[model samples]
Target chain A: MKRRLLLVSNSTLHGGGYLQHCQQQIQDFFGKNVKRILFVPYALHDRDAYTKTARDKFKTLGYEVDSVHETPDPVDAVRKAEGIFIGGGNTFRLLKALYDSKLVTEIRKRVLEDGIPYMGSSAGTNVSTISINTTNDMPIVYPPTFAAIGLVPFNINPHFLDADPNSKHMGETREQRIVQYHEELDTPCVLGLREGSMLLVEGNKATLLGSTKARLFQRGKQTTEHDPGSDLSFLLTEAQ
Target chain B: MKRRLLLVSNSTLHGGGYLQHCQQQIQDFFGKNVKRILFVPYALHDRDAYTKTARDKFKTLGYEVDSVHETPDPVDAVRKAEGIFIGGGNTFRLLKALYDSKLVTEIRKRVLEDGIPYMGSSAGTNVSTISINTTNDMPIVYPPTFAAIGLVPFNINPHFLDADPNSKHMGETREQRIVQYHEELDTPCVLGLREGSMLLVEGNKATLLGSTKARLFQRGKQTTEHDPGSDLSFLLTEAQ
Candidate 1:
C-alpha cells in the first residue's frame, strides 16, 4: 500500500475555529475506513487539554481520537493505530517528546511500512519533513538531536508569511532565514506553506491543496511560487 | 575585580554603519589600556570575511582584533587575550563552535573569574546569558548543549520588536514566544533587547544602554518596560 499524509500549515485560520479550514481535506484524506486515530499532543505544554480539544474536534467528524499520552506503551499505540494525527504547538517540545518516548522509529515504521494514514499541522507538519530545521517555534528545551521523522522529502515552514514592506522591523525576514539554512544545509528544498494551505501526499506523489499559493526554496535558486492544485511530487524524488 | 561586559543587541542598526551606533560605548567599555582583542567569528559562515570586517571596524576605534580562527590553539587564545569580542550571525552555530573548540569553559573563566572585558553583538549577546534559549536565530545546527557562558543571569531575545496591530500574521509575536518560553522555563527572566539597545554589566550590576527602551519578562509577573539607563542589577541576584 502507498503512504498517505495530510500536512497542514496551521490548525486555525485568522477569525476561524480550530482546524476549521482543513477539516474537509482531513476527512477526505482519512476517508470512512479509518474511524480511530492515535493523536500525538506532545507539542503542547498542557497535553491533557490539547488532547481533549483535539478529541472534540475529531469527534465532530465521527472519528474516535486516542491521544498517545493516555497509552501506557506509546510504541504499541503507534503500531495498532489505523491513522495518526499530530497537533501543533512547539516543535522543539514535540520533537523532544518524540525522542524521549523513542517513538520516532515506531511511527516511521507504521506510516512508511504499514502505510497508516498520517496527518499533522503546524509543528506536526514541521516534524513530518526531513528535519525540524525550518520551524518557527521557540527552542524552549533542547532535544537530543535535530533529526526528525522524514515523512516527506523536503522540510515545511508552516504558517509562512511574506515580509511586509511597510514594517520597520530590522530582524531577518522569513526568506532570509531560510536562505541562511540553505547556505549551511543546501540539499533539501524548503516548502513555505501559507495558512489555509496543505500538502496531500499519497505514496510518492504530492499535491498542493487549498486556495493559497505555496513558496518553494532551493539553494542558489530563486524561490518559486506554486499555485494551488500544482503537483509537488517531484520534491520526493529530489530528497538527498 | 568585577566582571565587565558590553552585550549589544545587534551589530548594525537601521541606517547606520556596522557597529557604528555602539562604537563609543564599546570603546568606553574596553578603555584605552585594552589594545589587543580576541575576536570570535564563528557565528558567521565566512569566518575570515567576518573577522576582517570586524577588524576594520574595531581599528577605527583604536583596537587590534585577532580572530580565534587564526590561532592554532583557540582555548589558549581565550586565556591570554586582554579583551574578547564575539560577532553576531547564528547563535546555534556560535554555541556549537564554542563547544567544538572546547572554549566555553575557558572563555567563561576569563569573563567570570579573570574579569576580562567582553563585548558581543546579536548571537554573541545571546550566549552571554544563561543559555541561548531566547535567541531569535534559526536552529541551523544542533550544538552539544544549550548551555552558554552565563555571564548574565537571564536570557536575551535580540532584535526585539512589538507585534504589529494592523497586520494579520498568524504566527506568534515576539512577546508571545517569550511568554511561551517562560511557561516552559520560568526561572530565568527574558530580556527583549531592541536593535539599538545594549546591556552594560559591571560586576553584578547591569544597566540598559542606548536610546531605546527594553522589555523585561518574568514568569507570573507582568511584562515591564524599562527606559535606557535604568538599572537592571536586580536581575543578577534572581538567577537560580
Candidate 2:
C-alpha cells in the first residue's frame, strides 16, 4: 500500500530543452533506492529514437533503463526493476500495446498489490487509470484497448486548457469536451492536468501536484477548480 | 421548441429487419408527423437500393422521399416538412460526415433547442448524445467524427449486450466499461441502452421508450439497473 507512483507529462520533453522541475521531483521521490527505472513508451512512435530518448532521461538521472518492449520476459524485467516510469506519447497506442501484451495487469500487480514504485507521464498517466477518456486526441482512434491498470481513479485529461490560440481548428474547448464527458459519466474523476501537474495517489489519499490548479467536474453541478500542491499531503498519508 | 427533426434507424427500415422490436416503438414515438424517410446506405454500392426502398416506406406512410446527405440544407429541406429521418449507416461515417459539414450544431439547434423529435436507430441513435463515448467499434479507426450534437447528457452505448456467443476478442464487458467509466469519470451517469430502450425526453419528462432495462453506475459503489418503461420523467423535466 506504500508503493510510490509518479505520473509525468510529455509536453515538457518537446523542443531541445526539458523541464527540470518535474524531473527533479521524480528523482527526489525515487531517492537512492531507485536503481532501475522501467521506461514505458507505448505512447510514442514505434521507432527506436523515441524509446532511446526516454531511456536516456532515466540514464541521465543515474538509473539503468529497460524499455518494457525490448525484453523477452516483461515479468522478469519488472521483477528486477526498482522503479517503473511510463513516458508520454499517444496514450491510445501505449495502452493498446499494454492491453494487447497483458502488461497492464502485471504492472498493476507490481505497483499496487506488490508495492512497486511506478511513474507515468502524459499518455503514461492517462492509461494508469481505468479508462483514457480524457485524452486530448481525435476520438476516432479505437485501439482495442479499453481496460487499464486501475492505479488511480479518474481519466487524465492531459495538456488540458483552452484551445491553443495558434491552432485554427474549431474543436470544442477542453472544458467543453470534459463537460460533455461529465455529462455522460457519473463516477470516474476527470483531472484536467496542467503542465507539471499530477494526482499522486498513495493508499487511500490522492494528492494533486504542480503549481497551477486542476479542474474537477461531477454530475450534479458545474466544474470546480482546485489549486494543486495545496493540502495534497493527505495523499501521502492516507491508506486505502 | 417543437421543431420537425426526424431520426432514422438502419435496423428498422427495409421491413424492419435488423432490429424488429424497435421499429414500432420508433414509429409510434414519431406518430403521424414523419413527413419523409431518407434511407441511407451502409456502403456506397447499396445507396440506390436504400433510396428506392426507403422511398417506398415513405410512400406507404404517406410521406415524401428526399435524398439525404451529410451537407443537406436543413432549413431548405425540413422547412416545409414535418420531420427529417436520417436512417442509420456506419455510425462513425455518418457522424464524421455530419461533423465535417458542421451540420451537427445546426441539427442540434433544430432538434434539441427547436424541439424537433430527432430519432435514430443503431448509429443514428448512437451519435445524438454529447460524444460517441459508448459505441461498440474496434479502436482501429480514429475518426475526427467522435464529436456529436449535444443532445443528451450521457453518451449512448448502443447495442448494450453482445448477444452473439462466439465473439473472440476479450475486452471489458459493456457493464465493466461503464463501471470503469464511472470510476474514471469525475461525475459519471452512463445509460447502458439495450436495443429497444430509449429515453423519451419530452418537456420535463424523459420517459423510457422500450421494455428493456438501463443500467447506471457510480464511483465507490455497486452498479444499479433500471427497468424499462419506468418513469425517467424527471431527467428531461429536471432543470440543468
Candidate 3:
C-alpha cells in the first residue's frame, strides 16, 4: 500500500465528541483491516489520560495500541505496525519528550522511508511539519527541541483562528502571521488548518479533508485560501 | 544627556503606518525632548531607501542618524546616545544582522546598565523581549532565534485587534493565545497591546498606557483585561 498520511486537529473536544471526528479520519485511512500503533508523546505528565485513552480507543477499534517510553531502540514498536497515529496535547511538551527519547527520528524514517500509514492529531499533526510557528505558546522557555517530521515541505500552524473580541493585540492577524511567514521564508509553504480538517498525503499527492478551509501561504506575498474542491489532488500527488 | 536611544519602527513616513502607533508610545516616553537617533540595522541591502530615509528623519529631529553597518564602533555610539531606536522592517533580516554583529548585547548593556532610554517599533519592539514568540513570522527556516535585548522581562504582542471578516483558519483567537502562553510560562507576562497601547517599565514597577484595554496572561490561563487610563504617572513613579 502507498504511504498514507492523516492530520487530525486538537482545537476542541467540546461535548466529549472530539474523538469522533478523528475516528472517521482513521477509518478512512485504515479501513476494516487497520491495525493501529498509537504514540502519546504529549502525555508525559499524565500518562493515564493521554496514553491510556489511546489504548482504550484502539482496543475498541479491535486494534492493539502500545505506549513507547524507555527503549534502547525507538523504532522497534512502530516499524512492525501498519498504521501510526500521534495524539494531541501540549505540542511543545510532546515534542520535547519525543526529542529527548530520540523517537522523532525513527518516526520520521518510518513515515518518510518505510512509508507507513502515518496519522497525527493536534500535537501529532504538529510534529509532521517543518516547524511549529502557529503554536500558541510563549518563547520565554526554550523546549530544547525543534520542528516536525518533515513529512511535507511546509510549516504547519495548527489550531489557527482569527482574532477574538477579548484580545488586545494588533498587527497581522493569524492570516497576517502566515503572510509574514511567507515574506520571510524562501521555501516551506505554511498550511493554516482548522479543526476537523486533514491534509491526506498518499503516493506523492496531498488532499484536504473535512469541513474547514485549508489555506496556503507562499513566500513574498499574502495567503490564498484553498478548499478540498480546489484541485486538492495536487497535495496527494506532489513529489516527496 | 542620557545615552541616545532611538525607537525604529517598521513603518515609514508614508506607508501601511503600523509603526506609527509604536512611535507615539516612544514619544510619550521621552516627551517633546525626544532626540531622534536613527539606526537602520537591516536596510544595508537597500542602502538608498533605508539609510536616506532614516537620516532624513533624524536630521528633522536635529539629532545624528547612523546605520549599524556604518558605525565602526557601535558600542561607542550606543554609549554616547541619549536614546537608541531600532525600527521594524523585515524582522528576521534585522534580527539576523543584529545577532550576527553582536549589536544586541551592546544595545542591551547601554539600556540596562547605562540607564539610557531605549525604544523600538514593530521589529524594534520585538527584539527587546527575552523571546520573540509574539512575532508574526515563520519559525521553521528561521529557527528559534529569540536573542533580543531583554530590556523587558516579558514579551510584547503589539498591534492587537480582533480577527478580520474574510479569513479561514480556526485555532485559538489572539486572546486564547495569551492564555496559552500564560499556561506555559511562569512569570513573564504577555502584554497584549492595541494600536495606541504601551507598557512603561522603570525598575521593578511597570504601567500600561493607551485608552484601550491591556490584557494580562499568566500561567496558561485566559487573559485578564485591564484599562490603563489616559495618565501614566503612577507607573513612572512606581518604576522610579
Position B126, candidate 1: lDDT: 91
Clashing pairs in 1: none
Instruction: List candidate 2 stretches off by more than 4 Å.
Output: A11-16, A139-141, A163-169, A232-240, B1-240
Q: Which ten contiguous residues of candidate 1 chain B have the minimum total lDDT? A: B179-188
lDDT of 3 at B33: 64
Q: Per-residue lDDT tens digits of candidate 1, residues A1-240? A: 378999999998888898899889988999999999999999987889999999999999989999999999998899899999999988998999999999999988899999999999999999888898889888889998888998877889999889888766677788888887887855588999999899999998899998699999987788899999999989888543
lDDT of 3 by residue, B1-240 (tens): 132333232343223343344445655565666465637556124645666666665564455666655777766776676667676554555676676676778888877787777767666777777667665443433433655667766666655555555534444456655554554534466566665556666554456654457655555445567786533223222121
**Candidate 3 structure quality by residue, lDDT tens digits, A160-238:** 6655665434344566556545544354666777666778878667778776787776665466787753455543323
**Against the true structure, candidate 1 has what lDDT?**
0.90
Native contacts present in each candidate (fraction): 0.56, 0.00, 0.31
Error of 1 at B104 (Å): 0.9
lDDT at residue B76 of model 3 (Cα atoms):
71
Please give each candidate's TM-score: 0.96, 0.52, 0.75
